[model samples]
Target: MGITQVQRLSAGALKPLAALVDDLGLAAHFQGDAMLNGIDPVIRSPHRLGEASGTAQLLIGIAGAAVWHARTGKKTDIAIDIIDALHYLHPTHFVQQQGQPILVDAEHVEVNDIFLCRDNRHVMLEAGPPYMKLLKGYLNFFDCGNSKKSFAREVAKWDSEKLETAMATAGLPACRAFSREEWLAHPQGAALGQVPVIEIEKIADGKPVPFQTPALSPLQGVRVLDFTHVLAGPRSTRTLAEYGADVLHISSPAYPDTFAQHIGVDVGKRCAYLDLRNADDLVTMKRLAARADVFTNTYRPGVNARFGLLPAQLAAASERGIVCMTANAYGHSGPWAERPGFDQNGQVASGFAWKEGEPHKPRFSPVFYLGDLMTGYFAAAGMMAALLRRSTEGGSYHVTLSLTRSAMWVQELGFLETTRQASLPERDSYPARMTSIDSVYGKVSFLAPPLTFSNLALPNASRLSPYGADVPEWPA
Candidate 1:
């Protein structure tokens, strides 16, 4: 039998929102129009990027409200402005520190950029820290230095196929751009098409546990153990923090991230460091996991399994059971499941890069990291749904999300092939969308939370914390 589409909103374009609610089995709890109001065309790119991003944000907001209702028996209305929601898709771009725009792009390494191969094909190399060691090996093998131009010149010596094969063999992250037809026929692309945008499963059984009632925010008193880095996972945890989840972000000094990469997203969360390989640190992590309501991580599939920190393991340790959420580059299934990747690689593999420019010349999506941003919001929604299930059904749930799957959702949203020409709305009105706050870095201006509830004021700008600034234990 073919899949049945559930119709909740009268607007056909909002079917995705309805589909998301139904997929999460949250149709009964959702109230209000299926489509989020005032977000049409705010993103204003070649595709309905803005609409999809806004819809994801709204879904998370609605889910957060639903969780609140579940705890307090009080229902609330949710809403989002299109422009405000769009800003969330690129949080770093909108951050202002000390009355100046913080330069967010400087963290990108020069060697980690797009280059043309001898076959006239373009390939993107994600030379970020996660792959820095492997990338350095590749660079040294090619006798190339730290210059983008030098890397490009050296990479031109080989065809795209050869370079791609070499990078894959070396365990470095890279993807050559492909045309729409080429991408559809790719094995990994086909596999991704068969997977759901968010995968949720009951991993362990437990006794019923009622959600803690909140005094101020919906998620107050909920403790979250966050072992995620970069954007997608951190952004999701950040969303939980905005709603009053007591989130403690964990990082590794062995694998360091720069201040610029962590600054904006670190708001409203305490930060700490832990080297899981160390015996004492591992014991400390297990203690935290045993007490945490949720455990979220972005490490690839088996990386945490080595540390005995997999979802089932964490669930076994917790007395009340716990919700586990994971986000990654490719996904948990298929040949690329264990492969290293980043948002740029997902965009290229998912045909976004190919479609951004002409057939001969490909362009990466420069506006935002849609894969990371949307996956963050989608993962947040899944975590909330799992929490709801735990509250009612008494089981530990695992929610898995991937950048590639998010890219497919964006593709499914399709492009806006309109004949009418349009330009982005003026930025003079943007000041109205921002809020100023005192932060660890300095006085900072940030975009307000895009989604809103009738009963709640916009969440205060996140209180920024320096990396590893807090102890590794939960608050008393």
Candidate 2:
């Protein structure tokens, strides 16, 4: 099996939203008392229409020392393992690895700890007394802008040796930067099993017909390893699982469980946690990949390959398997590949931000990660096609789909056409005549004053539910 990167949810202080998930019996599988902290209430709250959903979401940011006290009563040493996990997740951490000198922000709990703590492998329980808590609180109240001035004296007093000691406590590792392809090409990558596909078309009246259904159920026995998180990636996988892919979610011990619960994305899948940093955990992931036919993740290109879940690697492990079928707001190439992207950024880039909804006054809907989600579905369809090809040809295929590409497809019909075009006026000359308002918006409205078609049935002899509805027997 290849060395794949995995993250875990923090065992630090829990946030109010995380508590809500537990109280509501959501994420019941997350048994660890280690709290999920550092959630911004504005982002986490569900009160605002289409905005805050007061839902528990996966938070990948740093935690404050006060977070532990805010939720947990007992004062305990924060684990170095937790710190290491945060370092890998934090954007600043990545910048530092590039040898960029970052003027550490003492106001930021994680940043402060990076300067104060040294080792990267120790457990939080081993850290000294409640000092971490006091420091966290101080940072919380401290003026963020004046961090350099506020921490100047301490910074001066704490020499290189003291800083080294603190660094030792963090238990972090210096990973050599590897390209996405290099990461995917690791020898151990041959663990995830093959993904197969078959093409089927409907036949009616002794002729081939397009396949369509009241409810689409194209995937039956297929299994997916849902490694992607957040609304876009999760919702995409959820849609597939809803239709019928046996989705097994692989999560980091470091990410919040409430994220899946609040968004209602885990409904059709079995979820399990894995720590990618641990050798044994990587083995477990490989084993799971060995059985999973498809794998979806949100990490930008190189990240997954470093931990070993690349398409080539997956194909090597399982002949004809579809390894990486996920969407990146930004295409996998270009200078932006290393930078993180989200739906908002994608909207801005796709020109939809300027022209959508109000003219010159673009307003956004509550569509979190719509671009990624749609891209994911399109990617899923492509994977299905590739799987079919592999089954017939016995060769592997790499499939990629992007939101930008999809947006272009959407715009093509109007903007990039070669055939004769029809001009659509802003307002139609005939309002009632042009539109069949009834049944237009998923409502049962009278059409043409309830026209009685000559051949229409006189109505059912009796209401279908006249004898009362058949009650479903669900377990109490």
Candidate 3:
């Protein structure tokens, strides 16, 4: 609301904007079809993750062009309104169904918060209710009257490093907090430094194929096999669906998402359950992948390989070419690649949590979501880039991402505290940004997208479905 009329990047692309993006390896993409906008501070954090929200928009702009190019051999100009994108960090906060919120139980005090250890170091131990059965092995202080305070006391008994190692050994979720300087020196962090935020590699060969059918959105008819959970991975496919991709979100009955997580990210998709451990479900997921143009999985790094769902393997799943993408907790390489991770892990390991320490708390950031939400856009951008490459380069591709990698990029955006008298993006911006759609769950409201293209429409008209509400098969 501060400025209903946002400026365009190309005609008035400010030089000050380069400070955050110069090192991101996106100048080339920026120079390409993407024309970035919105260089103002919108988020409340002292960190630049919110101000750099435009980076996601830039990626979305580029993806929009790629979708347009692949869908119809014609070029198009895309404009991104970046405010609502950062709002997506906490999808449940903004979304509502039939006046009732879809909620994942958020009160897992024993499993969800940060605690101090004997090492005097901070570590976030996370195994949300949905993941407790999945990522096991941790302190067993479960009590008749257990509280966060009680859990903190138990956590303090273990050395931070040892607890981190123990959790990693058992494939549970936890990480020792690192300051920016510490992150640079840590072995796993060092390994992360060697890679890009989003990795898009051509893994197989296929002929270029352009869409012949007419469509209202850039990704219309594009089939996306979404085998993912939680915020980061699900948000990626949801963005793809907004572009008109036919996203099929699959999950297992054994490990279910919170109702809020399902409702927030289920827009414009077919949600189904298929436990890969089961012979028939495994076959079903593969069959869907075989017909998909995009394949995404968010299991810990190597878990997909066990099910024969590796990028290269799935790249060969379709002859027409597929954009295969994956998300892990840590970076794609190094000691922590196989360890499970989540947004909090990224926040802790990438130094954001430490930097966010307050006078009352040594390490904490209320709920800043750059790690999870923008990382989703990162993977989505990678998939779009891979899709663009497929339409022109004639090959199948693989895109990789991790929570830490995305969080690191946010750090690279530079801290906003250094800027002059920065306040939050205008509260007035809210009313203009909210978009309500009538779906299966009454009038559902969520943040609108930060991008627009000439003559193209957002897929908001599509209804949101409940988890596992649809069949596994693609539409006939």
Task: Please name the candidate that would achieve the greatest TM-score relative to the true structure.
Answer: 1
For all candidates in order, the CA lDDT equals: 0.76, 0.36, 0.71
Tens digit of per-residue lDDT, candidate 2, span 74-181: 232221122222222111112111223232122232322212212321111111111344345434433233243554334334443343334334421111111222
Q: Where in model 3 is the C-alpha error above 4 Å? A: 1-8, 11-38, 73-76, 80-82, 105-110, 134-145, 358-366, 418-432
Against the true structure, candidate 1 reaches a TM-score of 0.91
Who wins the lDDT comparison? 1
> What is residue 131's positional error in candidate 1, in angstroms?
7.3
TM-score of 3: 0.88
How much RMSD separates candidate 2 from the native structure? 23.7
Q: On a 0 to 100 scale, what is the lDDT of residue 375 in model 1?
A: 94
Candidate 2 segments exceeding 4 Å error: 1-217, 257-263, 357-362, 365-369, 413-476
TM-score per candidate: 0.91, 0.42, 0.88
